[model samples]
Target: MAIEWKGIFPAFTTKFTAADELDLPLFGKNLQAQIAAGIDGVILGGSLGEASVITTAEKETLTKYAVEQVAGKIPVVMNIAEGATAEAIRQAKLAAAWGAKGLMLLPPMRYKSDERETAEYFKAVAASTELPIMIYNNPVDYKVEVTLAIFDQLQAYSNIQAVKESTRDVSNVTRMISRFGDRFSLLCGVDTLAMEEMILGANGWVGGLVCAFPAETVAIYKLTKAGRIAEALAIYRWFLPLLELDLHPKLVQYIKLAEQQAGLGSELVRAPRLALVGEERTRILKVIDSAIATRPVLPDYLSL
Candidate 1:
C-alpha cells in the first residue's frame, strides 16, 4: 500500500465517547464515509485528531484499527508529534509495525528547535522507520519553520517524501515546485487554502473539515485537478465558511461539532479540551447549518 502522495487525505478527527474514551464505532463510520467519498488516504492522531491528549497506546490502537478498517483500500498514516527524538523514532517504528503505510511527522513538540535541530529531528525519525514520511511544515502553529534549507538537508532521505504545507502563504507552493521540482509531494494542510494551493499545483490536501464534509472536499480536489476550475470554485466558495473552522485553536472540538451536525461524529473531547459552549457553539453551528442548507449537488468528479 504505497502512498500515491496525491488527492484528498483527511486529517481525520478521533471520535470519543461522552466518557472520554475512543468511540471506535463512530470513528469507523466517519472513516467509511471518507473512503466512500474517495479520499486518497487517512491520517490518524493528527492535530485535529487531538494527538496531544490521546495517549501513545491509544494512537497505536488507532493505527491498528484504521489499517484494519481501510484494509488496503487506502493508506493509513499515523501522525508522530513527540517532544523527544527517541520517542518520535519509537512511535514511527510502532506505527509501521501496527500496519500504517505512512507517517505524518511534526517538528519536535513544545520546544522550538533551530534549523539544524529541526532537520536533525526529522532525519532521525525518517531513518528509524522504513515507512514513507510526510513532514508537517506548519510554522504558524508548531513554531519551528522547516525552511527550504532544512528541506535541502532532508533531500537525502528518500522516505521523507511529502509535506503537509501549512505555512499559510500560498506562494510557498510555487516556491517548493520551483525549488524542488517535485522532490517532495506538497499537500495543502490548511482547509481554507486547499483550493488555492491545489490550483497552484499542490499534489493533495490534508484537510481537517473533510472529516465532516468529505464529499465536498473530495469534489473540490478532483474538480481542481480535472481542470474544472469554475466548478471547483463554486463548491469551494460554498465550503469556505465551514473550512475556516480548521484554523481555530479548538479545531478538534469545532470539527467534531461539524461532524455531529453532518451526522458523522460527536463533539466529545478529552480533558483540557471542553466541548464548545455559549456563543461559540451557537455561532459555529450557524455556519455549519448554513453550509448544510445550501450544500451543493456535486458533479460526478470521479468520472474525471
Candidate 2:
C-alpha cells in the first residue's frame, strides 16, 4: 500500500452530526464516491477535515474507518498537523498501527518555527515512522513555509516522499521540478490552481472541493494528464466558481454546504466554526446551484 503520490487525493471533510459527533455513515458515503470516482488516495484529518478540533481518538477512529472502507483499494493517508513534534511523531506511529498507508505532515502548527526548527521537526517525525509522507507546504494559509532550502535538508529522509505545494504560484511546480527533479513527488494543494499546476508537471492534487465534486475534480486531473487540454479546460472553466470556495477562511463550512447541496454530506461544522447563514449562505448557494444546473456531461476519463 505504498503511496504512488500521483493523481487526485482529496483533503476530505469530516462529516459531523447536529450534536457535533462523527457522522460515519455520511462520511463513508462521500468516501465511497471519491473511490468510485477514481482518486489515487484519501487523506483524513486535514485542514478541510477540521483537524484542529478533532481529538486524537477521533483521528484514529477516522483513520481506521477510512482504512477499512477503502479496504486497500487505495491508500488511506492520515494528516498530522500537531503543534508539538513529539505529538506529531506519536500520531505518525499510531497512524501506522491503525493502517494508514501514508501521512500528510504540515510544519509544526500554531508556532511559526524558524527554518532550522521546521527541518528538525520534519526530520524527527520522518525518523519516527516508516510511513511515506507528503509535506504540506502551504505558506499562504499556514504562516510557515517549506522553502526549497528546507527541502534540501529534508531530502535525506527517504520516507518524505512528496509535497502538497500550496504556494499558489503555479511556477513553483516547475521550480520544484528544476531543483528536486524526481527526488520528491509534487502535488498541487490548492483547488483553484490544480489545472495550472498539473499542466506544469505536478504529480497529483490534494483537493478540498473534491470532497463535494469528486468526479469533476478527478476528471480535470485525468483529462489534463491524458493531454486532453481543451476538454479539461472546458470543465475547469465551468468548475472555476465552485473551486474558488476552497480559498476562503470558512472553507469547511463552505465545502460542507456544497456537499449538502450535492446530497453528499451535511453542513454541520464544529464549535468556533458555525455553518454559513444569511447573505453568505445565499451567495454561496448561488454558486453551487448554478454549477449543478450547468453541470457538464463527463467523458470516459478513466478510459483515457
What is the Cα-based TM-score of model 2? 0.99
Score each candidate by Cα lDDT.
Answer: 0.92, 0.93
lDDT of 1 by residue, 116-147 (tens): 99999999998888999999999999899999
Question: For model 1, which pairs clash?
Answer: none
lDDT (tens digit, per residue) of candidate 2 on 54-93: 9988988888999999988999999999999999999999
| Model 1 local distance difference test score | 0.92
Best by lDDT: 2
lDDT of 2 at 240: 95
What TM-score, to 2 decimals, does candidate 1 have? 0.99
Cα RMSD of all models vs. native, in order, equals 0.8, 0.7
